[model samples]
Target: MMTHWIKSNSTVFGKYLFVKGLSQKVNSKKFEVGKTVFQSLNGRDLLSFEGYTRNEVYSLLWVATELKNVQQSLRLGKRVGLIWSNPIAKASLTHASQNLESSLCCVHENQLFGSSNNYEMLGRSLASTSDIIFLDVPSWSQSNVEEFAAGSNRPVILISSRDLSPAVVYSELLSFYETYGFLRRVILVYLGPGNNPALNTYFTVFPTIGGHLRYVVDGVIESQASWEKGLRLATKFNTEIKQFEKVDEAIDRAHAISTCSHNLSHMHLKLKDVKEMDLDWTFVQSDSHKGLSVSKDLMKAAGHSLIHEVINNQSWIFQACIAAHTSDYRPIIQPPRFEGVD
Candidate 1:
């Protein structure tokens, strides 16, 4: 299914640009240097998929895939800090960073505010000392982001849920108003949402990438304007736009489904719902199986084809690795150790 998505846009980048790591496997025994060519995203923030070019998105995915099965330590010597509003989010990311040699300073949302100046000062202080900072708090102050960007031009990742409240969405737009090049270095990664920004970016670049591009917006997390924008884009690209009351109905006809519904309780992708889904069709969910939209059994059934937030989890690792390497600190790849055979 992914191959169909790739083949549809194969000629867009022309012949000169060869995508890396599609068919290759990482060598676990020998140490190998990453031969990633310097790109615009190196040492940059990844706030959202809104501003990324198609090539950049594609390259980033490939690099992330390469690093997914990496046997080496992604232990960057840099100081990476995380400021989270949600405890669940904090837990997931903290667990992912166990291998990394980062001094992860967790700043709760309540600790981030005081006076207007104090808020900006806190952001600056955090940015000044950290090599990479993750912002999972709802909304942001422009002054604070400006200060954070000014300190060292360090990469600031803005994480958003699949279903952002109307108020939070407004705050996000306001905070992203950066004229001082802060956005260029900012990477936007989705923690949850059905209308994923990464998928939107991919389809935007390769509009005619084949297959049906249908959107099921339940208004749980998406704003009126945002979903409309998606429809407008779909129409412009000659893609069919359809609606389904149940997600299973959509899955019945779809080659793949990446579900992230904010309804929480009423909506879920269970084993019964996916009975009609083709075995080869891909399945993805943002969160784990406890009280989430996707059930444990469905996740297990999806198997290797099931992607659990690759754009969110693996992209963060890729960005961290790239940031470390660009700053003259290469990630330490652990050499294979043979205990008895050697």
Candidate 2:
């Protein structure tokens, strides 16, 4: 019963990017997709090539395993909706979409390696499999959403970057988003000028009654990852609510450490040109019906340990990936979008 109120253009979580980036760099030079034989590498290839290397293998495990933990931490719970293109993108998203909480939409299904022309055929099948759907905002249309909405239960939708205001589309079908028993999460990516009044003006149309809305702004990764590796990072911040109903012993165990400064507003974030630091994160308490807050200094301190948590959580996801590898390669298409539907 947790929800993430994230807004921004780019926000990715966990150390998966660091490991995957390093692996990609190595694999880019070593393995050449179809050209390099699976057995050619002397030890291991970090980059993903179909299903051949340790990096690729473990990466999927990372997604299937760590995703659940991270989302649960944010209270996205067991069901999530992820939007990214390709198998690599699909696998990279493991951290957020793990277990049954995640549903994926390949926005550029037209570009999949072995894409098929039977668009509706794949669309109908995808509708049957997932409870929610994710789509690039520009590509989403009213007709397409309605067709899938016809089949889904508590479905979710995603729109990449603010290129297309969600209002134009959602305006036509306010009822779709407000459907009974459905909890749709709408994510808008704000790369920069994230606070444009034009976009904010349209916010009122989106119903909060049965949906979750988040603005995603990118945040600090490690200084090294952004500069040295050409990596992209986003904040995977968390909030802890003090529960009044919990046992007294547990309450006594809870503690908060104040930092030397409220650096929450400013940190010597590196590669400023290459990154965006979101200064605030909000936490909600269900029982108290009140909001809690944390300082930037506290965020910097707590976030420092993400790498360790990521490493420790890997073993189980890896096992799960290995078991599901063969069957996981099947194609999962996003339902088709209609042409020129307002």
Candidate 3:
């Protein structure tokens, strides 16, 4: 009957064969009448198998099951930090950082540091401590790595999206720090003039990736598609703001602006000054500017990728640590933090 079952259900039999291949000691001369049953017996086919003892088979199965559970638990509770250089990268990281925090049931912190323009500030921040840090800056210099490993005992993970040059990517990852630093303030300024007070105020302080300053103004009047895009962006922005320490203000602003009706034209007009402003100097503007020429889909894809990298990279780090330790044991690492110079 078992032979007939194996013949009829080839797929299941194939899986069994694959598992059997994981072992090396299959006795070819055992139980000719019940060969299939003997093969099906656990641990009998494993390379580690000595002789097919029923007790050993049960123990092997229990060990395998326990190991699987341990892996799952490790993945579900890993903490991570994400830091970025540019606005697009920041947005992507923000989207990703939030998702990872939720999926891993871990804490995710976002950071933004000036690179090229203010390498000193960037160095100071990245050189701080973090359990895991993802650098999304376009250009990375050697000094950056030295600073990253300056004070913390945490691991710094670097990520460069395809949009960045390879040279820059290499420089960023190579920059290491002993400790990771946290950004003090991430201000989001809304630069659009609208009858909807809610929209203006809500965008003004919406959190961006890397906890840097984000300025969202009216770029252009929203088409049907643009309106939908804006809604999605707003939804993400709203969700993350709730996780911030001072969430009550964000919640109040969101509630106040929820009832207001506005168009994309108003947003564009409000944000127009952003493009024209000289980014070389620190100047605050309340007007909108010409936004990025990319399509909404491209922007959304970037955001999705950013989130995946943040989550998966942490998982990779955890796996690497596990692999390094032969035992099925995990070490508890503290969250990375920046230690300011005394």
Candidate 4:
């Protein structure tokens, strides 16, 4: 039998070197953090969250949050091209793009990644036509992402949930942290026994921003794997990894709780289990299909406590708009206060 993989680090081998090389290449072309958000983010591929500084992440959240404040058609004349595998990802992004008044030319993963050498031609054509591109293939790894990025000149946002390379899709978590000012205790709950690589993004990000993140695991194997992963991440980030055996206990300590149970529509959170948490405790249902992990009634009870209530598909919209220079307004980026809980 193959040995079970147990440890988690911020990046896979050579990923750091690859990102550094890309950064240097971009810098050679006069690519640096620009005065405005549009200039700063334009013509970049967000393959992974590995190279982003805490300030950059915070600035992005600020930009995305600010995009929702205005009713103006920011992306009116711009066209967005999306290559997506996940149906939920495609639908969520389509909805968000429509709301922003951007025209979309979408290609399914089967059409783009099929057995054909025309990927380069297709990518070039798409890049020429679209202002920005979104790649949401969950199966694509770091190398796959890099290859796509290299083929296209337009900005590429990798929004997939993959093991080898984590996406910036979870930056909505940081946006929540910023919007709430700060939350001392945060709980990340996954419904099933299998390991969700999406959580790796959260593990890497929360530490950089400085916050208490606790993981709640149900299965014995999962708990062990999670504990080992947490240790490795803590060592890598020089922070503490708080793992809890009981969901209710974790919920009790958490000021905010987010769930990543995508397909577990049958599994629901019981009211009695979470009744002890403060009335103001925040709940985030991160899945595109709402109420898959938590019941609709419990979410109703959450009331004002529920945040990012819908799957935040709009982050991609703001990112595309920034890259395409669709907005003229340059909002100030303010850093959030960093706090670590004991």
RMSD of each: 13.0, 23.0, 23.8, 8.9
Candidate order by decreasing TM-score: 4, 1, 2, 3
Q: Model 1 misses residue 315 by how many Å?
A: 7.9
> Which segments of model 2 are wrong by more than 4 Å?
1-83, 86-92, 97-108, 112-122, 136-138, 141-143, 151-156, 159-202, 205-342
RMSD score of candidate 1 (Å)? 13.0
Report how far residue 289 has shifted in candidate 2, in Å.
Answer: 36
Question: Which of the numbered candidates is closest to the native, going by highest lDDT?
Answer: 4
What is the lDDT for 221 in model 2?
A: 20
Model 4 per-residue lDDT tens digits across residues 234-259:
44444434555566555554566666
Per-residue lDDT tens digits of candidate 3, residues 1-342? 111011111222421221112211212222111111111221111111113232322222223223323344333233444555444434444443343342211222233433434544443454343334455433444345435434333444333322212212111111111112221122222233222222322222222111222223333322222222222333333312221222223222221111112344433221223234312111111101224332234224421112223232333332332222122332233322211122
lDDT of 1 by residue, 289-312 (tens): 334566667766733224444423
TM-score of 2: 0.25
Off by over 4 Å in 3: 1-78, 86-129, 161-342
Q: What would the TM-scores of all predictions be?
A: 0.57, 0.25, 0.23, 0.68
For candidate 2, lDDT tens digit of each residue in 1-342? 232222222222432222333421111121111211112222221111212232332233333333333443322222223334323324433543543334344445345226433433444555565434444332434344444444444333323223222211222122221222121222221111223321232232222211222322224221222122112111111111111211222213221111111122221122221124332221111101112223234333432212223222332332223223312321122211111112
Itemize residue pairs with steric clashes in candidate 4: none
The lowest-lDDT stretch of 10 consecutive residues in candidate 3 is 1-10
